[model samples]
Target: MGPVNKNTFDIGPALHRAILGAGGHDVAISDSMLASNGAASTREAKAFIADARDAGQTPLKASEVEQIHAMPDKAAAKLVALQIDLDPARSEMVAIAQIEGVWCRAMIDNVPLDARLPIYDFKTCENASPEACQKTILNYGYDVQAEHYRQVWQAATGEDRVFRFVFQEKTAPHEVCVIELGAGTLLIAGKKIARAREMWDKCMQANQWPGYPLGVKRVDPANWAIERWPKR
Candidate 1:
């Protein structure tokens, strides 16, 4: 439901035509294995498939398609087990708000209008285990994203809501992990957001954007980094 590759978008209807139905969308079996060359039905089917693309239709193939299809199974194993249905309109909920007079927007992955559930944001990655995700969380500043989404949601709905990240692996196995921030992490995130907001406000007021720091500063590597580097 989040921003997936372009192939995923058009593949849905194609699969529906090829396989009768895939991911609840119709993709007719497009592979013409039985219809011999120069056969009238084969020509018609090919024409129809093209027309479907032009008019929009489903038929599903390619090893790439297999990999893409595999993704839903893994994702569903987790989300379905948790009773989460990412139906359209419910997924990709856009929330916009004005924070400290600065406009902000959030494209939330899933928000159940009918039930009480923590807001869920999705991320595709190389690993979804807790340990792997912890490093990723910090490296990618997902904590900041969680805090930002929370702020935007609060501003729009006037309700304080919990946030969760649904991290799914991009490769084989496609493992998934659902994570929530602890109190300490949330506190840290709040501070980071505040600092960023202050910087944004200042930039807006001055109408001057900045690149890297103009001031000359010393650079030093951490002990761990120094130790990790190989000796030549």
Candidate 2:
């Protein structure tokens, strides 16, 4: 939760910050303050932070280690069902690129073969069905994430790659599904990224950061609300 470091922008959070109309400076300051204050709320969190500071691999908490040891062998089976390759090297690959006058970096969850090929992101959620997962993706800006990663990879290698999400339920009877973005959704994501970048660039150039709009906005009732309580 360090400062936003306006000099370097991470595509994922930058898009979100811009979309929410949050000024980069304020967001950076706020995040840093929060991180500073909340760094040691839990023993596990403190240990992880210490490991990160020491440049060593962070160890899982004792409880987490125990859980992992006790868990059934379901992950491998689920991946096999999803047709995902079991290459350890493919997991947690970092990609870096400079796009739209900003440095961007992404840690791809998995890439089966060549670095320029298709990428897969693993997500554990409540529902793995396409309809439910699509809603979750949009609500969580995963579409923007797909486009951001795609742009970063393309910028680095000059080749576009397919991005897919491998979603599975967090509970028992873990249902799994692989999802790819539709052309329409990708188009919308591209537009969103463009708008976010535009907003960021404008704010950077002006050297002035503004918060939410200055004037009061009108609030209107929705059709459902009107139907439920019609004016007499």
Span of ten consecutive residues with least summed lDDT in model 1? 13-22
Q: Residue by residue across 172-224, what tens digits does model 2's lDDT show?
A: 56567779988899899999987877787788889888898888899999888
For model 1, state the Cα shift of residue 187 in Å.
1.2
lDDT of 1 by residue, 1-232 (tens): 5432334225533322222112443344444532654232566565655554554444343443675577667877787798766654566678999988878899877766754568877777788899988899999899999999889888998868788887777678878898888878889999999889889999989999999978889989989888889763
After superposing candidate 2, which stretches have Cα over 4 Å from the reference?
A: 1-72, 115-117, 228-232
Q: Model 1, stretches more than 4 Å misplaced?
A: 1-61, 226-232
Which candidate number would show the highest TM-score if scored against the true structure? 1
**How badly does each model clash, as a count of residue pairs?**
21, 0
Which pairs of residues clash in candidate 2, taking residues 3 or more apart in a chain or in different chains? none
- What is every candidate's alpha-carbon RMSD to the true fold? 7.6, 10.5
